[model samples]
Structure formats: structure tokens, C-alpha cells
Target: MRGTVWVASDIHLGEAVPQTARAFYDFLGRARREAGTLILCGDLFDAWIGDDHALRRPPRWLATALDELRATAGALPLWLARGNRDFLMGRALADALGARLLEAPAVLDTDAGPILLAHGDEFCTDDLAYQRFRRIVHTPWIQRIFLALPLGARRAIAARARARSRQARRSKPMAIMDVNPAAVAQALRAAGCDTLIHGHTHRPAVHALELDGRAARRYVLPDWEFDHDAPPRGGWIEIDAAGIRLEQL
Candidate 1:
């Protein structure tokens, strides 16, 4: 589509993250009228186990917010990517909201330009171990097995997994928590796209890198965190008739 799309990632919505949850809700309200599409890069939820997580007796605010958005978003396209945290999301919810689940390294024709969208975690080549593990967990067979587990069990396992990921982060080098510049260039080269937008490292910056002897822009989207001072930064990459603008409202 030749129109503006709101792009953002690393929401990690839920699990008592009230600030982020509220900001996302507000962002959605604005995007409903502002953009042609809403591209949620990944980690839409802190941890989405399955459809049962959505129907739990103990209603969660995130689930309610999602339902409300889905209803209000109307015909606007909702495109989602599977991120490190909310990889468990599937077609069940997608069908409910008319959302599209994007494959890894998906391409989007933004009003600004043709851009490559990724979760950005796979670009952390410095963390070779995580790369290897990501491959295994991403396989169809493994994903199927995980999806078959009871929702309660899946929820429990997810908590433990997050704790383990935290432990690993504490032990690993700082670079492991960030994207590898070489990997980013490699991905851009393979995708044959200059602009790459993703959110994972939580480092929000516009990086200019050389790809195939040509200059390409890689935008790192910031995660939703309210502890910061300045107007509660981290929103969407807004593109209008003029060009792309980062709206931190």
C-alpha cells in the first residue's frame, strides 16, 4: 500500500507493565486515525502463551486492551512480528483481530521507502549461542510441540524461561544484549533493502551503515519504558506526505 504506516516494536506489553500498556493503548488510539497501517514489529506482549492466555478467568488488562484495539482499529491493517518475548502468538489471535503474522525478515513498502523489518534479535551475531538456540526453537516441529502444551503449563514455563534469559544476560557481555553491526549489514545485503527497522536491543537510534558500498539507514526502535524523564519517550515512526518522523508523544 502506498500510505503511511506506524512502526514500533519491543512493547513487552503486560505483566504489570502499566506504563507501557497505557502508552500503547494511547498510541493505538492515535494510529487508528493517523496511519494506514499499524506495524507491530515484535514482542507485542511480554509473554503470550496461547489463545487460552486470552480467555483466562483472571482477565488481564493487556488482553482487554488488545480486544478494544482490535475492535476500534476497524479496517486498518495490523501487522505483527514474532519477537523474542511474545513468539508464542499464533493465528488464533491473528484471526480474531484480522492481524497478519509476518515471517522473519519481512519486507514492507513504507511511504518513505521499501524497508526490511526484523525483530533484530537474530542480528546479534555476537551472541553465537543465542543464534544457535533461536534456530532450534524456531523450527516448525519445535514450535508445534510448544504450542501443544497446556496453557497453564506454557505460562509457567514462560516465566521460568524469562528468569533464565535474565540470568544469561547478567552473565554475558554487554554486546550480547545489542545487535551486531556486521549482522545488520549482512541482513540488509541479503534482503536487498537499504532501510531496516527493528526493535530488540532497546537502543533507539538511527544508524547509517554501508551496505554493498552503498549507504543504508538502520533504525532502532525504542521499547516502551516510562521511567525516563522526557515526555515518556518511545512511540512510532510516523511517515506523512513530507517524510518519516519519529513522534515521541
Candidate 2:
């Protein structure tokens, strides 16, 4: 996907956040009308135990979100990327939604220029525990075992994991949770790209950095939360010939 590219992530759509889902649906409508290609960077769902569970028996909320995504895909190129929570998303989910699965750390040759894209959690090298947990859960055998379980069992397990994660975050230092500078620099160098765009830290901003005696920019995407928060928040990054810009909901 090139030309005018629109990227968003960390929407975390689920049963609880109807307002957020609605806001995202609206954004999809806008993207269909405006964007040349749309890329959902990651975490489009709060949790995705398995694609079978969602496709076989989608609740009202999931159905609506899927429909919205399908509608958007029908209008333009729609790409989905796996996030930390929705790492289980597979080709089946993308096919069902009429979208294509996008590989993380992908380099896009866009109108603005070539830019590296990622989900961003992999860059949080400061959090040793989370990185260790990430390694365990990402094991192929472990994931297959988890997905083979019953949907209800998977739901219970996911609930417990989420609870534990929230509790753990309460005790962890804030800096540890964000991406490490060294990791970011390494990723940019490895990818041979000067511009990096990602979501997961929920700290949306364009950071200026020096890499190999040259300028580099990292764009962090914001997470969406509209139901309980005092200020409803959501946004996306737009890349075009003009420049890269952030738009808010």
C-alpha cells in the first residue's frame, strides 16, 4: 500500500467499549472515503483467543466490528497486524473480515517515504518480566495448546491474565513499560529505515533522534478509550506527499 496511507492501532475493541467501537466504525467510514490504503497496526481487539472462536460464534459486538471492517475493506485496501493481546489473529480472521494480514516491522514505500512499522511491544526491552512472558506465550506449542482449549476456558484464562497484567503494571516503574531507546535505535538500524511508526505504549508523539549521525523519527500511536475516561481519546497517523500528520477523534 502506498500513496496516502492511514495507520491506526490499539483500539482494543470489545463488548465493554461500545463508544470506542462506534468511534472506530466512524473512523473506518472516513478512511474508506479518504485514505488510499488503511493499515490497522495492532490490538484491534482486547483479546483474541482464537479465530475459530470468533468466527464460529461472534457476539453482537464482534459481529458489528467485523461488518464495519468488511465494509471498509470492500471500499479500499485494508491491512491488519497482530498486537500483543490479539497475537492469535491469523489468516482466517483476516479473510473473514475481507482484509489482508500485514506482517509487523514491515517497511512501507509510501508517498511520504519508506517507513518502518511495528506493534511496538517488542521494543519495550526494559520490562524483563513482560518480555519473558511474551516469549513464553509466543511459543508455537504453547499457543497451539491454548487455542485448542474450549472457548469458555480460553475466556477465563484471558480474564485472569488481564487482571494479573493490570496488577503487575501498578507496581512496575513507568519508564520500564515504555520502549527502550537502544531497542528503538537497533530496530531502525536493522530495518535500514530512518522513520518508525508503531503503537502499544499509548504515548502518541513524534520523537526526534540521531541514528548513525542522521536524523530519525519515531511515531507512537495512542490507545483508544471512550467509555469511562473523562476525555474520550483516539487517533491515527496519516502519511502522504504533503507530510506525516496525526489526526484525533
Q: What is the Cα-based lDDT of residue 102 in candidate 2?
A: 94
- The top-ranked prediction according to TM-score is 2
Give per-residue CA lDDT, model 2, range 34-68, as digits (tens).
99999999999999889998799799999889899
Query: Model 1 over residues 123-206: C-alpha lDDT tens digits?
Result: 888898788878887798987788789877887888998888888889998977788888888888888899888888887888
Off by over 4 Å in 2: none
TM-score per model over all chains: 0.91, 0.98
Residue pairs in clash, model 2: none
In angstroms, give how far residue 219 of model 1 lies from its true place: 0.4
70: Cα error in model 2, Å? 0.7
